[model samples]
Target: MYSKFLILLLLSAFCTSCGSKPETTRPVTGTITESVYASGVIKGENQYQVYSTVNGLVEKVLVSEGDLVKKGTPVIQLVGKVAMLNTENAGLAAAYSRISANGERLSELENNISLARQKMNNDASLFERQKNLWDQKIGTRLEYEQRELAYSNAVNAFETAKLRYNEALKQLRFQEQQSQKNLQILQTSAKDYIIKSESEGQVYDILKKAGEMVTPQTAIAIIGDASRFLIELQIDEYDIAKIKIGQKILVNMDSYRGTTFEAKVSRVIPYMNERSKSFTIEAVFVKAPQTLYPNLTCEANIVISHKEKALTIPRDYLLDGGYVLLQKEKKQKVSTGLMDYQRVEILGGLKGDENLIKPQ
Candidate 1:
């Protein structure tokens, strides 16, 4: 009888302890997402380093660092003494004058050709009259031969005159071409003295100072459009597969304390860094702050996957190996697809109406 009473007490204690475990709440309907958190730096899209295209002394620096500039604005002025001197000493003026003189000479050649044509016509009339007299047997053949020789000489002179006229036209064309080419060189020299901006942007740096001798390809200034900015982040090798273009992102910059901005993934670089074993990704802000600056450090959360209006449970309920104890009754094994830092996506094995529990 004593042994039976001990067994009954132990059984009752075991049942009471089983009933004492607390109940856990399951999420009913909300969006569940998988995300990755990372750090990044802000940069502009239109950043470029400006360089000079001609060798000269920097006569003036019209823009200082941090000055806003527009397209075609003169950022620097250079004086090319050799180039200017060459232009002044060259035969450009003489070439233009020669082209004008060639035009007048071509007109004179045309007049000479007209006079040769008139002489040829008169000689041909005389030769035809002498031919008619010889055919009628009333004039000597020598007279006809002399008139024919005169006509032939007239024809030769006319042909020579036409050839000279055509030659003069060709010379005129050649002179025009030479003059135009020279004028173009002079125009280029005038424009080369001024260094113009290629785009509308802010001047971020000035590499050359006034009176500095700069050659073609020497960096003059750094300019970029500051209005557009993006965050460049590196994803670890383990988490790179979870990032994709067009993913929604939450960004927080260290400069904007306690504030966050919405952004979207714009690019995912295909290649990975061999040394760091990471891949780079870029995100563009949906609502950018007015005070954003380049190289600003930012933290980003990349949302990889999502579930809409589905059942979810607190992440703490997951046990070792992603198993969960449900209502302290059954061990539910779930297949996960995506997860945030706290919550994970349940792919299968859990019914929408099942109960969940938190492990102590």
Candidate 2:
């Protein structure tokens, strides 16, 4: 009978221990932060791909990857035999068409004009002398008429010579101007064969080799500012509305593992990326890493709001639809506020001293 009583006692104890005894904890006063998550890459300021304006075989690459360059620096030289020949031909044409080159021809025209004027003056004198002789009754009528006709012919010849000289001078000037303009254009075009950097920066990549063919459409190199860098992030569409310029951002980069960097949003691209279904935004580093390079992958969290002291509980303890389990398996609804990955803010229905049961 004592053994039976002992066995009953053990069974009762086992059943009692197995009965539901839920774990519980009270809410604590702490800080809570709400933020949006993003992921993107690092880009140097003013980064851009370099392209040549004309088509040619690359004869030499003047700048290598990681070379520092100034604005208007020569980056590549192209094989421009045809361009050189065209320029030379244009120069020769310009030289031959110069007004000074036709000095001898103009001199001949001037000489003819002078001769015509002298003959015209001589004819006028003879005609006057003949008229005087006829008036004095010492010359025949035929002689007077002949002298008048000769004077008229000499005047016409003089005018014709002057007209021819003026026309020749005008033609020469026009040709000179036209040829000079053509030479200037060809000279500018020849300079296009030497590709130059458009901005002051460092060359990050040289995309083409010395023997590769390049056209205006081909990018020959990549360049950007050497010292300045920015973070480019794509924020999901659901959280895009929370993003704003000047918001604080916490950045983590793969290159700098375990280190968090602070940055601020500088720009928000107003357009959405159709493929990614995300909005693109840019941020400038406030506390930058010692060394940074272009195209570094990074993850970021943009802080939207924060509270230093709030009644908060672990996210797992809170049930869906804003309810929490209390003692005796009772459910009570709670008004919530700002939340993060691990915690949720309880604004109402739960005091800091109440024990909340973990839901099974």
Candidate 3:
């Protein structure tokens, strides 16, 4: 009797413990995504820092901040007296070569040519009369020889005058063309003194004031196509390789707090920034926000992979060797696929209905 009672008590205690064991949650099907974190800024299409091409004093600023301008619109005027003077001198030289070249010097050559022809005519007549006299034996040989020598000298003089005229005309014409070319070069240089917008946009800011000495490297203003905007991202070197053009980006902007926007990577600048150790990426809005401004701070997640329905569990529930604790403290290994910060996808070795224990 005593042995039977001891056996009953042990059996009742074991059954109570089994009946009171805690329940566990089952794995559920859900969406999972793998992504990389990135930070960036909003910018307009063709956005850029404006700079002058020449170093000079800012003579005048033509456009104010937020002023709308057209392409080829003058933004800043620089003072360059030397450039203007060079243009003026070139113009004067071109005019001299074209107009004054045919003026006095050419006229003198023309007159000289005419005079030489007339003298040659007179000398030829004398020479012919003397030759006839000699042939008839009516004059001394010395007289005929002297007339022939005079005619030869006249012919040489006329030819020399004609050659000189042609040479002078060529020289003057060449000078005119060269001077005109020099004028054009000087005019182009003068244009550098006036900074113009390359695209139509509003001036975001002006960095120079009147009387300030500015260099070609100095920023004068900011401009872009205001109606269009894109995101400029600076991704760390380690993450750049995984990023590619056309990747979907999940964006969060500082300006638009609590709101998430969507964008697609448009460009990935190939070279790494040696100093910053980062790479640049460009993205355009898929469904842009209602509005955007230049240089707005933003954060983005470059999606690498995603699944609409996946077997997922809290990342903390996964242990070393890809094992998961199940009901009754059972352990099973699982293969993982896409994973994010909070959860990981189980590709195999687990079913959706299996109860999983919350990690202690």
Candidate 4:
């Protein structure tokens, strides 16, 4: 009986030793902020890629990276040999088809018309004289009939000459007008070879080099406002609905380590990126860094809510389904409020001084 009793005592002590004390924490009064995390890059205001409107060999890169530019400034010149040749050919055609250049042809038609008019007049006078003589019974009938036939032929010839002159004039005028329009079109197309800046800003990058072939699909350079910058962030679709314009943002960048910058959400893109399943948002700096560049990487937290002096405990102290363990290993449910990475605010079911055990 004593042996069995000693075995029982030893088993009790072993069981007690195996059951370790659970870790514990008490609710504290402090500030807690609820925020949504986002990752993004810094971009210059109005940044965009420059593309050529026409395909050609890059004749020269007119502006280098980091150069200040004005609106309508020529940035890149393309080799436009073919376009130039076409323009020149069009100009030649225009000049050759001008009314002045074809004046000799028109003048020849006019002279024919004038000569036909004189012949018609002379034949009519002869026919009138022959008729008078015939009526007075002094001329043969054959002579009067021949004069009448000659006058009729002369009148027909005159009308045909006038018609030929008018048709020739109309054809010449049409040729001149068509050639002018073609020349204008070719000249406008030739100007496309010179790529110009669409905005006044700094040149961030020159993507194409001299002697490189570029198409309308290829980017020629990068340009944007040099003095202003903004943050472009991608928020997860799950958290996107929580985001709103004018929300406060805390920004951190690898380039500027150990510093957090203040910013505000300026815009939210309504559309979500299907491939990434994220929504894009933009923010402007409240107090910007002195020096900034386009495409600098950054991460940000958008503040959703904040509470000052709320009863809070470490996040690990709360178990699944908002339950916490008491000193006697009793489970108590708590209402939650604002939460951060480290702490969560307790809204109910826990007093300010309760000792809560962390979840195993």
Which runs in model 1 stand beyond 4 Å of their true positions? 1-33, 37-40, 44-46, 54-57, 85-99, 189-193, 211-219, 226-246, 266-282, 306-334, 341-360
- Candidate 2 lands at a TM-score of 0.77
TM-scores for every candidate against the unseen true structure:
0.67, 0.77, 0.81, 0.80
lDDT of 2 at 302: 97
Task: State each model's CA lDDT, in order.
Answer: 0.81, 0.94, 0.90, 0.94
lDDT of 3: 0.90
Per-residue CA lDDT of candidate 1, range 121-185, in tens? Answer: 99999999999888899688889999999999999999999999888777777767776678678
Ranking of predictions according to lDDT: 2, 4, 3, 1
| Candidate 3 runs further than 4 Å off | 1-28, 313-335, 349-360
| TM-score winner | 3
Candidate 3 residue-wise lDDT, 100-217, digit = tens: 7568999999899999999999999999999999999989999999999999999999999999999999899899999999999999999999999998987878989999998978
Tens-place lDDT digits, model 4, residues 85-184: 9999999999999989998999999999999999999999999999999999988999999999999999999999999999998998999999999999
lDDT of 2 by residue, 1-360 (tens): 999999999999999989958889899999999999999999989989999989999999998889999999999999988888999999999999988999999999999999999999999999999999999999799999999999999999999999999999999999999999999998989999999999999999999998999999989999999999999999999999999899999999989999999999999999998998999999999989999999999999999999999999999999989999888879999999999999999999987788899998
Q: lDDT (0-100) at residue 258 of candidate 4? A: 100
- Clashing pairs for model 2 are none
